[model samples]
Target: MTCDRLVCANCAAPVNEGRCPVCRASRERLQQQEGVLGALTPAALLVLLVALVAVAVLARSFAG
Candidate 1:
């Protein structure tokens, strides 16, 4: 899960703030697990999907 709204059990603060050692470690781990696609926000992915669908539909219509 994203750390922005995560409440740290150790510090009782947002994990994004890295308010404690646990928060910092968790944040680091989350960052390490993320790659190219993970970098895209939900909205960005949705837009990309819509664009792909549009391209597919247009291509199919032209082909037939």
Candidate 2:
């Protein structure tokens, strides 16, 4: 649940836009809880996953 999809009940706007104080505070809190990888887009994370799999496959091949 990224902030991008969150709705601000106080401002009636998307949380990511932070239209009001409440929205801003909520966005900040959510971002903090999400950590570093949580900020990454789905596509970027997918690429990372693929890269990790490739690395593991290469490592296994080398070890054998």
Candidate 3:
């Protein structure tokens, strides 16, 4: 999803290079996107899932 590897359809060049107006525009748009979540890693997602499970287990024990 990052612009570094994207090719510009208008100029047939890499978006990161900004070889043309179209490339520059596209790169800018991609950069403005939200943080690493827009490109989440599997490890991070796994950690989040584990945390959620732990919270649910703790809540159940407390209620019992």
Per-residue lDDT of model 2, residues 1-64, tens digit only: 6788899999799999999999999988987898888778899999999999999999999999
Show model 1 residue runs off by greater than 4 Å. Answer: none
- Sort by lDDT, top down from the best: 1, 2, 3
Predicted candidate 3 versus true structure: per-residue lDDT over 1-64, tens digit per residue: 7886788899899899999999988888887784768666679889999999999999999999
Sort the candidates on TM-score, descending order. Answer: 1, 2, 3
**Model 3 residue 17 CA deviation in Å:** 3.1
What digit string (tens of lDDT, one per residue) describes model 1 on residues 9-49? 99899999997899999999998888778889999999999
Q: List the residue pairs that clash in candidate 3.
A: none
Worst 10 residues of 3 by lDDT: 32-41
Angstrom error of the Cα, residue 20, model 1: value is 1.8
| Residue 1 displacement (Å), model 2 | 2.9
Candidate 2 residue spans exceeding 4 A from truth: none
Query: Model 3 TM-score?
Result: 0.60
TM-score (all chains, Cα) for each model: 0.81, 0.74, 0.60
Q: Quick one: best TM-score, which candidate? A: 1
